[model samples]
Target: MGPVANVHADTLLIVGDSLSAAHGIEREAGWVALLRERVGDAHEVVNASISGDTTSGGAARLPDLLERHSPDIVLLELGGNDGLRGLSPQQMKLNLRTMIEKSQAADARVLLLGIEIPPNYGAAYTDAFRGVFRQLSEEYAVPLVPFILDGVALQDDMMQEDGIHPNAAAQPTILDNVWEKLGPMLSRDTDRNE
Candidate 1:
């Protein structure tokens, strides 16, 4: 969709890991790029994702990103790498909560992009990691895209050879998942501005 007629665009800053960094693929083929196309002139999408970044890294870098972009929306997509590394879920939650609190303090609406690690991580750990996003979203009153790679991850063709990152073909599907929650936020933001 194109920009809303005569509506001012909002800046959307994405702070994520390899999933949003378009690892092992063309940068333009990443889901964040697809999101730029989807929102058109309605919003400015800033991709600040780093390959192999964890929640702790995101927490440390967020203040800089927030100051640099002053985004109307901040998308949090960290924690996957933390889970893959077997980091403590409690620490991950603390890092995420720190990011969320910082973003809200800066007056940027936050959107948590939930992530689910492979079951190999064990039910106890994986469940806790997955629940962090939900807990934070509910606690902070922010919107969440439950499992950003929802329709894409399970499909072999949609993923890259490593099976960790989604391929170009899966970008649109990932964007659709984010759009489900993001669209409403955009609408509400636009309405409020008017």
Candidate 2:
């Protein structure tokens, strides 16, 4: 854990909702914390996730976060609340775009962590909801983790009683999912910083 020569190029900021917030688990046991441990002081990880936060909230709060942290990478794990609440996917997309643009303008690399709503929401609506992340990734040229909870969400043993959030045991898997995209980003950022 050496001192970072440039904080802005070594800090990793995560703006997300309950999933990233570690809603029903210990803070240190959450996937974000696991990510912190995995990085092992290579970069500072700041978790600014708020439970029940929507994309609109993240968009509204991003400028302050960017200005404060000057992160090299920004992970967005929002929109689950919006989908759960049946918010318009167009609005969600716009909000996400705003956040992405802001992060890019701030010179930070962006990673989109896509999430899916339950199948009960009807295929058309669910598809649109999921498509927002893909479209944004394409339009903005940012990396996307197609489904952050891909394996954990469906497994009963991995999920919490509410069935929405993953349990403590699932943290490692979540970190692995995020690391798939995030690892490369961190390497690139490190190379650039050096």
Candidate 2 per-residue lDDT, tens place, 1-194, comes to 88656444388899999999999999999999999998875789999999999999999999999999999889999999999999999999999999999999999989999999999999999999999999999999999999999889889999999999999999999999999999998888667767
Query: Whole-model Cα lDDT per candidate?
Result: 0.92, 0.94
Best by TM-score: 2
TM-score per model over all chains: 0.94, 0.95
At residue 11, candidate 2 shows an lDDT of 86
List candidate 2 stretches off by more than 4 Å: 1-9
* Model 1 per-residue lDDT tens digits across residues 1-194: 97556557799999999989999889998889988988888799999999999999999999999999999899999988898889999999999999999999999999999999999989999889889989999999999997999998879999988989898899889888998998999999888988
